[model samples]
Target chain A: MGGLAVIEVVALDGDDTLWHSEQMFVDTQARFRDLLAPHVDLDHAALDARLLEVERRNLSTLGYGVKAFTLSLIETAIEVTEGRVLGRDVQAIVDLGKALLDHPVQLLDGVPEAVDALTGRYRVMIITKGDLLHQESKVARSGLAEDLWAVEIVSEKDAPTYERVLRRHRIDPASFVMVGNSVRSDVLPVLALGGRAVHVPYHVTWELEQPDHDPADGDFPVLAGLTHLPACLEAMGAEAA
Target chain B: MGGLAVIEVVALDGDDTLWHSEQMFVDTQARFRDLLAPHVDLDHAALDARLLEVERRNLSTLGYGVKAFTLSLIETAIEVTEGRVLGRDVQAIVDLGKALLDHPVQLLDGVPEAVDALTGRYRVMIITKGDLLHQESKVARSGLAEDLWAVEIVSEKDAPTYERVLRRHRIDPASFVMVGNSVRSDVLPVLALGGRAVHVPYHVTWELEQPDHDPADGDFPVLAGLTHLPACLEAMGAEAA
Candidate 1:
């Protein structure tokens, strides 16, 4: 507890951190590449880069979610095929989007236990960014709803968003710890706002959410997995005591 | 100043109430029928009936919004054509969704004046139900954001939902007023919770939201148009005075 390390609230990221999310996007993109192989020989890297370009452009208008992703896929398909995209290809992409939406929520290593462990001891809420319907679907299907506090589905994860959420609940950011898989969204933003964060790396990450720089010393703690969360919190608690 | 007439907050339904919403759905469905005419000779009424059936079924699974509407169109297209729906039709329907998403928000008559008039006099919030993104798009594009106290994009408009929104804002439901076009969603539910309601009928009504029967006496007040809202509130305020 070197300086204000006592945790009174825990904010969890929905995708990849608590459950498998990025993997679906990854799989969808791979299938997209295969679907268009005959029309173009663009490698996966180049195709992904093109898709990201389209997604970033559409983000302002479309925001984020599976629907936006599906739109980007269709836009990319049209772009690569020079607007000669076959009718079947467009429908196939739509089906891919539907599959992503219909996919079941898969909880990672230690979800309810980690969240349940901190329930009464700390005010816990899930703060995740994505389409509200898609995010709510993940929450409803996750079966982790009752074990935690409210689930906030926001447009983006930034300092202002974090501040608003924390202040609304009357929780001081200094005592708040955000647990998630992205350093860019989950860790750095919280740290910037004087809140604590714990990084639990997933097997795959969304390319856009990757941070350009590394975390410096005293920035935040990195956990091997969610199972290690209670220990980390307890150690911090001991230091504070 | 009839009875319990002082108003502290005004909750407006987003689509149809504050802006044109159902008309867009009607126009899109028209185009859908035309596209499928070559495969099936179903009349507009029959086509609309089938689409509604599919939508009701998907409501539990897909929820609502432009995205769900597009998916339902695709599903209906497939069902009517016995899985022989052309790829071109799928692309065409997707275009319709994008168009709806991209449509400019047209504020109903005197919406700004109504919301602005009530802004400082009461806590004003838009309680809209639909796809969060679609509803959000309308709000963002409506140019009415600055006047609203808050915009609550919800999944359903039931008694419990209205109760939760009111309790969250710490407003006594008795002093709150709900204004919208759907009696089923806006009037009955709010009135059931002992709140007042103002019904402003839209030109077109979605079949699902149409009330099964007429509202009884003392159900709520009815207005000819949104232009009449400020005056109605004033009358109520005068009564309480």
Candidate 2:
């Protein structure tokens, strides 16, 4: 057991961790590239970089969400095409945003079993960040609502944000473990606050969510997938015991 | 004082309640009308009506806030203009949304005084509903952050939402009071839950926020302005005492 603290609560990130989400963004970005193909001679990679630039510029004003992404796409189209982009194409981008919002909630393999396994033994909750209404709707549609202790949809997942959430819920960081797909968001912040974190990498990550340095730079356990989460936590529990 | 419940907490609705917000929406609506005039022969009133229709239709999908408003505006332009609206016009609507986001948070007259008057006598907090990041940023800019005990930015202000917030914070409905500008959001929900509410009408209200019928249909005190809030609460306190 050494000096390790026993984990009492397990908190997981919503997007990409429990469900297929980043893949939708990837598909939408592809659709965006296709829509611009006729108006611009640039490669897909170059166009994506330009849209990313617009997103970065608008981030402070628009924050984060499908709406922000859609706005950036429209702006990028307008800029790259030099106003030659037709209004119908602009409308297509808006439809893309709508489709993303109305996308069905698809749970990843082993998600329900992992949550069920952890439910009785530990306080399981979801701590996700994004557009509030959109996230709330997704949680409602996820069918995991009745099994969790609490659900917090924050605007960001920084160290201070994590600290505030933990304090508000009266959960000690020493006994808290955050499992998610983004190391920059769900992993690093929790670890910085003296908490435990498990990384479950998704197949495709949003460029903005990627960490500049190698995620392996951090001292945390990495799981092959969510199916491996329960066993990993149990081993840690044994060590603490 | 017989049977009257003593108020222990004072919660306020942000936006048009503590600051000028609806007027900005009104002004933006005017600009939207102007942008469409060249492409369509419809009068301002008809154009405004069409835009409202689009907003109502998109509410469930887009929820609320500047982003939602902007999306609706873009969609309306495309529909009414019959594909004649230029990309530049769509870009103009996006700029309008950005301006709304960047608009200075102007505290209504005597707001600071009213909040200050209520501060030490009771636990003061803000219960605002809108985009999470946008609402949070507005709070930070409002200069009233230090005076509030807590701030809740929710997606909607329905009865269930109020109940969840009150129960989570361990606040008794009998001892709570909500003050705001929207009768539908700030008044009806609290009153339905046996909590008291005070309505302080703003000069301009968003059509969506307006109640279906007369707001006086409900049983609650109505103040002429925020400056009178402290005195009204004190009288309620005396009655309960």
Q: Which stretches of candidate 2 lie over 4 Å from their true place?
A: A1-4, A214-217, B1-4, B214-217
Residue pairs with clashing backbones, model 1: B1-B239
What is candidate 2's lDDT per residue for B1-241, written digit by digit as tens?
1244889999999999999998999999899888888899999889989999999999999998889899899999999988778878888989999999999999999999999999978999999988888999999999999988889999999999999999989998989999999999999988888888999999988889988656555578889999999889988888778
Model 1 lDDT, residue B126, Cα: 92
Tens digits of per-residue lDDT, candidate 1, A170-204, equal 88777888999999889888887888888999988
Q: After superposition, how far is residue A181 of candidate 1 from its true place, in Å?
A: 1.2
Interface RMSD of 2: 0.9
- Each candidate structure's TM-score, on Cα atoms with residue i matched to residue i, is 0.85, 0.96
Q: What total of clashing residue pairs does each candidate reach?
A: 1, 0
Interface RMSD of 1: 3.8
What lDDT would each prediction earn against the true structure? Answer: 0.82, 0.90
Ten consecutive residues with minimal summed lDDT in candidate 1 chain B?
B212-221
Expressed as tens digits, the lDDT of each residue in B1-241 for candidate 1 is 2347578889899899999989999999999999999998788888899999998977765667887788788778877877666655666877898888889889988888878778878888899987666677789888888878878877788888888788777888778889999988988888878888899999988888988655463556789888899889888667656
